[model samples]
Target: MLTGKQKRFLRAEAHHLNPIFQVGKGGVNDALIKHIKEAIEVRELMKIRILDNCEEDKHEVAEALAKGARAELVQLIGLTVVLYKESRDNKRIELPKSK
Candidate 1:
């Protein structure tokens, strides 16, 4: 679990990033999860966009993606969801200490 400060730091880091993936009407699936896992392993932080045509709720989609990818859900604003995970081989982000 991420602390409040950690989440805020991640959100700021992700602010300028463009959505690397988009959830469409088909919703979350194994293929999408697989790709997300692979991407997050390298990037540590990533953003996903929820399309207007997506059938599931934005919160549901965000949860599913975060759970599927084993990443932290940093933020879900508007139609975008930010995710973060500590990369084992390619670690990048340094999260703030939890008090």
Candidate 2:
């Protein structure tokens, strides 16, 4: 779990990043989850965009992706969702220490 400061820090770090994945009408699936897990292992932080054509709610899509990839949901603004996870082998981000 991330503290408030940690989440804020992550959100700021992710501000300039582009969404690497898009969730469309098909919604979340096993293949998407698998790919997300692999990507998150390397990127640590990533953004996913929920397209206008998507059938599910943005919040639900964000939750599913975060849960599926076992990553923290940092922020969901507009159509984009930011996620973070401590990489096991390819760790990069250094989160702020909790108080």
Per-candidate clashes, comma-separated:
0, 0
What lDDT tens digits, residue by residue, belong to model 2 across residues 1-99?
999999999999999999999999999999999999999999999999999999999999999999999999999999999999999999788988898
lDDT of 1 by residue, 1-99 (tens): 999999999999999999999999999999999999999999999999999999999999999999999999999999999999999999888988898
Clashes of 2: 0
lDDT (CA) per prediction: 0.96, 0.94
Question: Which stretches of model 1 miss by more than 4 angstroms?
Answer: none
What TM-scores do the predictions have? Answer: 0.98, 0.97
Instruction: State residue 87's C-alpha deviation in candidate 2, in Å.
Output: 0.2
Off by more than 4 A, model 2: none
The TM-score, computed over Cα atoms with residue i paired to residue i, of candidate 2 is 0.97
